[model samples]
Target: MSLLQSQVPGNLRLRSIDGTERLVGYSPPTRQNHGVAAVVGFEEQELLRDIKRALLRGVLIVGGGSLLALGMTLLVARRFIAAPTDALLQAARRWRAGDLAARAPGAARHSEFGQLAGAFNRMAVALQQREEELRHHAQLLEDRVADRTQALREANARLEAEILERRNTQTALLQAQKLQAVGQLAGGIAHDFNNVLQAVLGGVALIAKRAGDPAAVARLTGMVEEAAQRGQSITRRLLAFSRREELRADRLDVGALLVGLREVLAATLGAAIRVEVEAPPALPPVFADRGQLETVLVNLATNARDAMEKGGRLTLLAEPVTVAAGDPGGLATGDYIRVTVADTGAGMDAETLARAGEPFFTTKPVGRGTGLGLAMARSFAEGSGGRMTIASKPGCGTRITLWLPAMAVAAEPAAPVPAPRPGALPARCARVLLVDDEPVVREVLATQLADAGYKVTEAGDGAAALALLAGGLACDILVSDLAMEGIDGVTLIREARRARPALPAILVTGYAGDAAALAVGQRVEGSFTLLRKPVTGAQLADQVAALLGWRETV
Candidate 1:
């Protein structure tokens, strides 16, 4: 007890019985023992050894449990977090490389990682759906773009064609306007010029009959007749150009006409140009206006000559052709006499050829060409129930073709009987009334009728002639100029016929308009005879005698 209390108050260090150091603690005296102390002692080394062994055991158990728990956690993380994340990464990489079908694995697991993977898969599905929709829309857009592009191309082509057609129509309209202007000018000129020619022709005829020297009469009359004929030709051309000339359709011997035109063309084309005509002897006849045909041929020849400035060959050829229905040339389906005028000369280019038939469209220098040649030729051909076509190229020479309807059976033309001369008139005198606006024209015509053994009555105008007729002037025949100041010949004839329904009247006109007017006014058939002026004395006498039923006896 004394030893236990020797050092510390409650704790003591001693050598234990096993020869190890010990540590002890003592309690104070208890009441039950009346001063006895309670001691609690242990071997310090053994206690420390037990605590160390327990600590070692606890450490081993805890460490093993911790390792097991760590392994389980690692397994859970790999399956739930890392594995799903790796799968999503792989799927993402594939998706990034344009694989919209790629999806993450482990979506069936009920863990958070499974939920995360599910959401990622849903997002990927949505993205893929969106991508598919975008792809489909893109394809549709491409197709629509292609269709629109094609439509635009077609519309552009149609627009271009319409523009070209409109341009051609405008060109035709411009040509028509020019032709109208030219026609108006030609018509006015022809009216005045024809009156002058009528006076000259009538005066020449009178002078020729009165001349004493036969040789002088023949020579002077021949010159005057020739001059009058030239003037008449000029007027006819003017009327034809104005489209005012009445066409006289007749059966023509085309081959003979072509042969006759050879020398005339040679002289007209000059020595430099060579003209060749080729027409079969048995070529079919064409029913057309003879003067118009001749004029067209002359115009074509002139054009060919002009084209061959450096001297080239011109060929006029004729052949029979059969036109079919719906022909491109708009010709009637029938047998036709085809005439071609070809020239080996400077040819027209595409643009010039297109406008070849347009009025006032010329490639020639000013004053050298009227530009009406082709236009007039085309008009004549059409008017004659034919068609004209031009074929040419830049280097290749031109070929202008005319297709005239061929007569199936042509009758031989009757020989023109000579008009009875004034000396050969019947002894029975017929009363005549001649009316004219011009004093010179009236006096000359009155002299002609008097010389033909007819009692002549003259009036200065249609009104005077009507006044005379109304005053009961006995007239077996009435001849009047168509165009007059107050009452026109048509009106005078109409009034005169009312009084003498059996009276035969002759209407002479220089202007085509007056002839048309007379035609419109005359309703009765065979009521009148129309003579174109410059009527000869012999012609007037024959007509007067014919009206009176007086034929010259042999």
Candidate 2:
């Protein structure tokens, strides 16, 4: 290599020394001009430069050692910085990938970095705990919803059943109302009819009782008696519907009534079943509407008869009861006269028994029975302040008890009123007041009483009757219809009592039920009598004569 080439790549000028270091002239190499000649001087100075280089090497040794130490520190710092950061980055990546189980670096080479890693670990744990809490809460919410849904379903079913039952009950009540209306109408018309029949028979009886012509009297008497008997039958049926008769409200010795009815009861039930009556002697009498009581009896008897299709013994029993269980067929406990009718026959289950008192539930084939008998009997009993109960099992027999409330004391038997003395008919000379709403009924009653020889005064309304009485009209007997438009019979009765307290009064009405009859009967402190509708001349005379103390005759 030439002098310029022989130099180190970056060395431009050479330093020369002659036992002392010195700067020489710098040379720039020309393309081909300079050769090894220029380097001779530089070469000669190399030995001297070698000595200077050795001296410089000794001076730089300490700094070089320091620099080596600094380089080692920097290498360690880079490794530490990258290690924690890499770990934190890797942990974050796992957390972000939905891995809650990943744990962040908690221990670190440096204090500050260790805390940061710990914070990351804490945050990850908190997130995992929150997720678990959310899952558990959601499960509880689902369970609650399921429970509520089931409860709602049960409530809906119960409500539907109640609604259906209410509908059936409503239908039955309406039918009962209709049937009651029909019965009331029938009873109202029958009273007048009975009166007319009584008059016809009484006049015929008068003629037949005394005539000497046996053949003619016998023929006429036979016709009249037969007609009267038929009339009596019709009246009996009407009374059954109206719940009225010659009611003698005594301590009803129920045992006696049942015993007396034995023969007839057996025939009614037929030879298939044995009808039995068991009554403790000296059983207390029940204070009740006798006709209504009989209706209950007949209804229960018939029900027992129907229950024993294959021939079974039916027992009719009576016991003087002092007190009973609470809620006996929804009746409160009380002192009662218990009449029991039991049948050893095909029994009823709960479902059938529940519908027993419904107006029209019949197990018999259609037209074989009308279902009103039991309902009417129950209504009558209830109206008379009594109750009834039924007990039965699936295969066992049925027992029904009539619970009749007892009176404070057993009433003494009433003395029978004597019949009119022979040919001692009352002087029909009294002036009478007749008040009624129905014009035809008023005319009929007035004509009958007039034919019997009484001076009859007629008024179509209560106010007219009251006005006539207030005007000092001479009146011996006051006859008034119970129900009227302006002033009813009750108001008129009060006014009449105020007008003349000793005035003889009689009330005629279409309604003769225990409730209605009691309403009037309770007001009988004075001499007031009630004659049910459809009164005849003879009954009219009988009641009037009884009230006014006039002579009575056939």
Candidate 3:
């Protein structure tokens, strides 16, 4: 191998021979055509040993330089990025844990970390401000709620007080209204009563002056009787208007009623207003209470007179009418007597007309009107199964119409005449027990009974009468006045009846209602009679005589 290697030049080759590696170099001749070569050979491991050592040195130096660069990078990252990141994370954690004051440490620097930290801090300040504002709003709301609750409580208390006061005021107003109505009625009554009293007084004075002259005395006495009758009529009218008297509905001739009311209307309306009544004689009779109808007519006449302040014509007319079912006037389907009272005077407006029949609604000045006139008239007409209507317009006068149910003519049974006894013998005188609380009344009644040929025993009161009866005083008839202080007439008569079951009794009372009630009871017992006062002495005598089966003398 050595001899062959000397032939090559500038060329080396590695060869493996006998499990050993060798390096071989070849050097060729300078000329291309020369075949001469030089060769050199060495072990391959020995030649590669120095080259491997140089490569190991280069690797060690490079590894050390890379490690130093890595260390520097780590240190710079820890100082510039990691520390700030850790601070931001810590601040975020603290803030999440409810530490609102916590801030990132790098916020003062001008780096990106500083900018992030500054933004985060700004967000925290905004959140804190929002939370405080919410708390302040909540506190204000709670305060307003409490204040509103207290205000409501006070208002409720004030409302209750106002209600109570209003109720009391209403009660007082109602009482005042009643008083006003009563005062108006009393004024009219006083005017009428004064005239009656004057007549009575004049007659009494004339009778006293002409006592010796029989004709003059008789005339004066008649005048006095007439005046007393007038007073009685006034009282009955007053009772009817006040609704104290019971209703006595009967068939009434509308024409006659209107004719009779003409004089009264003229007097009530004064001489200024001209009054006219036009009633058809053939008009059907109406079924209504006579007194109530009179009252209604009087009320209408007065209202017309008041409306005619400038003295206008007042006219009253009545006619027969027939109505069908569901009539516009709301009257029954039957014949009716339509009575109208019209006045050519200042009229009512629509509002006034609508409320014309409402009670306590008056157009007249406070003291001049009761306001119940039209209301009462309407009530009476409706109560009698009829209807009342009013028509009026401003400056067009007023007309009031009443539709009263017509009554069919019924045949009245002839009054039975008492049979004359055989030979017309005088009846036996009756013993009468007269009981009254007033001495003058008792004495006058006793004298009347005596003049009628009756044996009379007088007692001042029901108690005295009972005492006399219990003492066995013989009496065929018991006459007693109701409303006594002790043992009233009703009790006295009841006790007397127990002792004398067949004893005839006459109950005299000033109160018509009491007399009516007693009359109902007496009708059931057939042994008692009732007499309403303003009863004359002659009337009492006649009643006593009738009770005793005595014929009245001419």
Q: Scored by CA lDDT, what does every candidate get?
A: 0.78, 0.72, 0.80
lDDT of 3 by residue, 243-349 (tens): 67776887788898788667455555666888898987667687789878888887788788788888989999998888988977666688888899999989999
Task: Please give, for residues 1-554, the per-residue lDDT of candidate 1 as tens digits.
Answer: 65434443477798877787889877666555576667888888877987899999999999999999999999988866787778888988998998878877888989776787788889989998999899999999999999999999999999999999766755665566456545534554455456557656765776767687777667767767766765665555556544576667887888877776664566557678888989987887888886677778877887887788889998989999998999986888999999999999889998999999998678866445557779988998898889899999876789999989998875779998666565553534878999999999889889988988899999998888888988989888889888888988777888887888777788888875455555653454446778878788778887777766633333
Over 200-237, each residue of candidate 2 has an lDDT whose tens digit, in order, gives 67758776676987787777776665665545545554
lDDT of 1: 0.78
Per-prediction TM-score: 0.52, 0.44, 0.60
Error of 1 at 376 (Å): 9.4
Tell me the spans in candidate 1 whose CA falls farther than 4 Å from its real position.
1-212, 247-283, 288-306, 310-336, 348-396, 410-428, 513-515, 520-526, 550-554
Predicted structure with the largest lDDT when compared to the true one: 3
Worst-scoring 10-residue span by lDDT in model 3: 2-11
TM-score, candidate 1, is 0.52
Q: Tell me the lDDT of candidate 2.
A: 0.72
How many angstroms is residue 470 displaced in model 2 relative to the true structure, after the best TM-score fit? Answer: 7.5
